[model samples]
Target: MIIIVFHIDSQERTYIERITQDTAEGIKTLLKNDLEKRITSLSEQSKLSVISSGMSQSDWDAISKNLYGTQYGYQAIGWIDSTFHVRKRIPKHNNEVTIDFNLALNPPALLTAIKAQDTQQRAVTMPLAFIHGDEGIGIHIPIFNANTRGNKLDGFISGVLLFKPYIKSVVPDFLLNEYYFTLFIDGHKVYSDQSNQPAIAYAWSKSSSYYLQGHEWEINVSPNDEFLYIAHYKVMRILIALGLFITFIIVLAAYTYLFARSKLKDERYKIEHLLKNLPGMAYHSSNTINRPMILVSDGCENLTGYSRAEFKKNRMLWRKIIHEDDFKRVEKSLNEAFKVNSPFELEYRIITKNSSIKLVWEKGGPVSSIFNGEIIIEGFINDITSIKEAEADLISSYAFSDAVVNSVVEAVITIDQHGLIQSFNFAAQVMFGYSADEVKNKNITILMPTPFCDQHDQHLAQYLKTKQTHIIGVGRELIAKRRDGTQFPIHLSVSEIQNHENTMFVGLIRDITKQRASEEQARLHTEQLAHAERVNALGEMAAGIAHEINQPLTAISLFSQTAKNFCEKGKLEKLPSIFEKLSLHSRRAGAVIERMQLMTKKGQRSKEVIDCIFMIKEVINLAESEARLRNITIRMTACDEAVDVFVDRVQIEQVILNLLRNGMEAMQLNTCDNGSKIELEIKLNEDKNVEISVTDTGAGLAQEMRERLFKPFSSTKENGTGIGLSISKSIIEEHGGHINFCDNKPTGAIFMFTLPIYEKRSRE
Candidate 1:
């Protein structure tokens, strides 16, 4: 009995020793591997941060927080500059005091950092006390400037690893509970969980070593009192009771059988739980024509709205549930897969017990039945209705957007940040004289003219870099080039579309060639209309003009006669004064003719600065004789200051003369008993504009005539051409002014117009 107990004890001790050795090796390996992985990750991150430019505080904090979460062994992660100054640290709330700490204060860490920088590699320091009172080692990863040719050292990413927490983290709780451990670094004990009590002499112990980053770490593992009591002493006592060995053997066999059965039952329960929680249905089916279901998981009810018992009772239930349209395809796929003894995938619709249709995807393969070794099919079916619906929605969205873009009348173009055209709509194709295929992937500069095309790329790059916009979100009228090499005006509005992945520009372009042409034609027509009106006014004043010219001509003729007589008489001394008078009369006749010529000339309208008061005086002079014939008096009022206006002189004169003539005619027709008068006033208004008013003491306009007063071809007088007021309004508005008529206080009508006061800057 003693020999058997001794042998059992020896064998148990040997077994325990072997387990202890393996545990020690495993712990050492786990610690080494975990540290190496963490250091490698830190090194890679450090290099990436440096390559990105420099290790900023945010970058450092991000890396530190990530390491703190994933590499939990680290007490703190920090950045040390090239000068060995601690610039940043993790767990900012707790470790903020460590920032700006000089690494020189800790000789070991400083040495490690210096070595890492010099060699441009990773280095580690010996275990030392950190500022936070935790004993740990420092891991330093060097960073260098990638942009420099010399690869100058930049900084170091340092991680402080706590001893006890690191060991506890790497070693599993089960292993830790059964075993006592001692951690050593370079032969010096750093951590040990053994109490001050003298170690048990019978405890099993083993030591294992692992090397990492030039440092040697040893883990010593030993079974505690509980493990020893159960595995060695108690077992020895059991072996000593040799008389009950047969009974013990019988009981052991039964226990082994029951334990195995319990284990199998537990495994089955886990599998059942897993299938119940599965997102869809799992099934086993017979490899037959109908593919009858042999077994189904609990999820079958959720997926098909039918109980498992129903599927078992009705062998044709699966076939009946398959949509008629997809059953044949499903059967064909299954047959093909079965023939080749391979896996199959199918997507089809199925009708649930409630008569609702659902789209399902199935992936299955042939397998041998454990009970009979017959081939059977097993598969998982998942509802994919939502996925299919989402796909359809996405496709429809894209199609709708495309249709809308193409339907617009203006050109719609989308370009990537690089200025390459990505999409060109139908309008763009028609406007630019290019097919969508021809312009796609082409630079947007192809549609721009001259210097703009050459500078487009540079401008785009500048905007991307500086984010300063010149034309984005703003509309500009610019010249655009067509495929035919013709340049035309286009109004382009560009908008920026930005997302996380990329930036794009959408350009809306409108071809304004026809619009510009129409405008030019309108301007020419206005000039012609103004000239025709001036000619007509001159014709109306012909009699008065002839009478006025006759006086000057008659005087000139008399002066010439007198001068000729003086010369004939040889009174040369008196002839000088006679000749002077002749010159004055001739000059006066020339001035009258020049004024007439100006009024009659037909040409493009040219604006020049002229005094408003002076222009009114000239108009009155021409119309004075006509007014006198109509028995109407013309009066003028002016301001002391000269009000200069920029306008076409002939156009303004025509407007005033038409007003004067109309007033005189109205008074003649009305035959007012009181003397009729037309008053012209020129003054500066509050808007700094030259305001001229013509008041007529004749019959005032009626209310009905006011509405259509400025409309062409609408007149109150029987012989009046309504175009006079219409033309006057157009001419005044064109000169940045307005004209309107209102009833005077008591009687007659008042015609008032204002022209912007001309400044020197306006001409420029």
Candidate 2:
């Protein structure tokens, strides 16, 4: 792994360069450990010098205040005791100060007085000065002031007579021991033992008297001579105790050595006795000799049915006892141990006197010349026939599992956690249209569609963390992308297998595309049959009703023409009577034809993009005669411009005509209605499809007939054909649209159909 640091604003890069040109040799030289050792030595040296000097009790406070310019503060460097102590070393003009300031406790400093000339070691002194007062006043301050307000004779009495005579009799009581000197210059510490170099020094003086009334000091000489005599007495005592301790240790070691030797001999005797009576073979060999020889114990004869005399002198006899197939393996095992200077263990077969193969477990290790005068291999062999048979049974179990997987009808594929394809059964090859050789080591995402390819790794990571999987232990139907780039639906079942630390998944997939296609085709056929029935029933109703009403309609038209002709010829006196007769017949004939037209429209294809207003006007004109005969008026309100659509123009025109006729029949049948009228409206829809609604004010469909009204052969009228709505349904659906019917407010039914307006693509 490499660490690359880049500045986000400037894109400037810096690399941690590996400048150790002899990197391989540096690794072999253990350079990191060596560097760590050197750093530890420097840290220890700094610690030892500070601890030995007692700077806390002397002038550390004065030195720190002058040098660091702090009355009291601490700097943490490293551990001083179990708890880490902040050791502050302050360098002054001529000497440095060392202080252990542990803030956890209200702490004090260890002080050492350093003479400027000697800066390497601290000077040790004892009981330098003593002064006393009545309470806290003179405990830690100067002795006195020099000037006094008094007469000359009175000053002489206080100074020369009283204080001056008392000062002449004072001296120090204690001595200074092992005094060494140190100095500091320009923040660097220099010691007296280092060199006789130019440096500042401070010396201590013994004051005889303080004139504070009988205060005294005395300094002792010959301090080192007295200390050396005391150290010699302590050393003699320590040597006598150490001599006793060494004598005790020597006695204990000699007793333990003899006891351990005796116990080891007993163990060796027990092992040799056990080997003689063991059920299997035991032997030792010396490979270090010019010619290696095998020493066979008596138990070897029992295992191989060969006398030890025959094998001991002849190493070839040992090979003869091994089965022919096992001899090469035994030789290989021995050669490997000698090559690596390690141990050897193997299981193979040997031949006994009964002419049967016996499984043997053998283990050996190299040893120095102890049992013999040469380096040797010593081992024991055991019969392992039972274990060999158990292993054979395990192999048979795996073979059965393999057979079951191959026999399955669905495609099966196995992939490891890394998504590398591990195994693909024969059925999988055929289902994916890939040969086994082509897919091995390929990513499983080859079978996934685009977005799935991008998101599959994220899905794997989520499942691994949560231990939740959507596809495992359950079957799902999903689309699988094939090698040919075509997609088909499949039912896939996945199972996860974890062995040791490795995770794998097995997917069993079966193609279901053909089955779904067959079901869809059947559904469409059923719909067509229902539509055919509706059309046939409506045709029969229209034919029957139209045939019965046609003669009456012709008679009404003839009488109306005759009355109009007489009126035009100036027969005014007879006009009112004839006109009344003409009107009654005309109204009755219009009602009969209106019923016929509603049920009798036939299917015909009409393709056009006719203006919506014009189409509605033409259909209204065709239904006008029928409407007039029933005293029912037809109304139309259409958009000024044409709203065109791609459609079978004739069929839709017929549909409009049928709706007008149905509307006239509905309004004429209701005697209580104020106006006998039908309205047709055409308008553009928001989605660019044209909606045509034909609403009637006729009596609405009966509750029983409403549910089944558009079904094949279902009708409410005695002379009704039930095929109109069903046929209309088929026509609209064929144009990629739909038709629906709803109750028209307080009465009648509203039939509505939508067709998309045609959009033409421009040529490039």
Global Cα RMSD, each model? 25.9, 34.9
1-764, model 2: which lDDT tens digit per residue?
01221132122111101211122222223322332332343233333333323246344344323322321111211222212233433332211221343323421111211120123221222212111110100001001112445311110000001111111221111212321222222223321222342221111111111111122122111213333334333444455667788999999999999999799889988987988888777877666422234776778766777677766666445555578887777787788888888989998888886777888998888777665466678888877887789889989987887778778888889988878788888788878888878989898888878877777777877877798878788999977888899888889898999999988989998999888899668545634553344344345345434544666667767777877888799877877887777677667667655544543444333477777667667566455655656777777767666776776665666567656666666676676184566777777778778888887788867788777866766766556566656666666777777777888887877878888877766322
- List, residue by residue over 1-764, the lDDT tens digit for candidate 1: 67877777778878988888988888878888888898888877765544232557676666667767876767778877778887877877667668899989988888888888777789989888888777889889887777788987777778888887877787888887888888888998888877552367324678999776677888888888788888788776665555588778999999999899789879988999999999899999888766678999888888899998988876446888899999989999998998999999989999998999999999999999998999999999998999999999999999999999999999999999999999999999999999999988999999988999999999999999999989999999999999999999999999999999999999999999999999989878867776776777678778877777788788878878887887898877887787777788778677777877888887666888888888888888778867766768899999999778888998899888888887777667778544577788888888888888888777788888888889888887786656888888998998889998888767788899998987765211
Highest lDDT: which candidate?
1
Off by over 4 Å in 2: 1-321, 328-347, 352-356, 361-366, 371-373, 378-391, 526-764
Instruction: List lDDT for all candidates, in order.
Output: 0.84, 0.55
Model 1 lDDT, residue 456, Cα: 91
Q: In model 1, where is the ten-residue run with the lowest total lDDT?
A: 46-55
TM per candidate: 0.47, 0.34
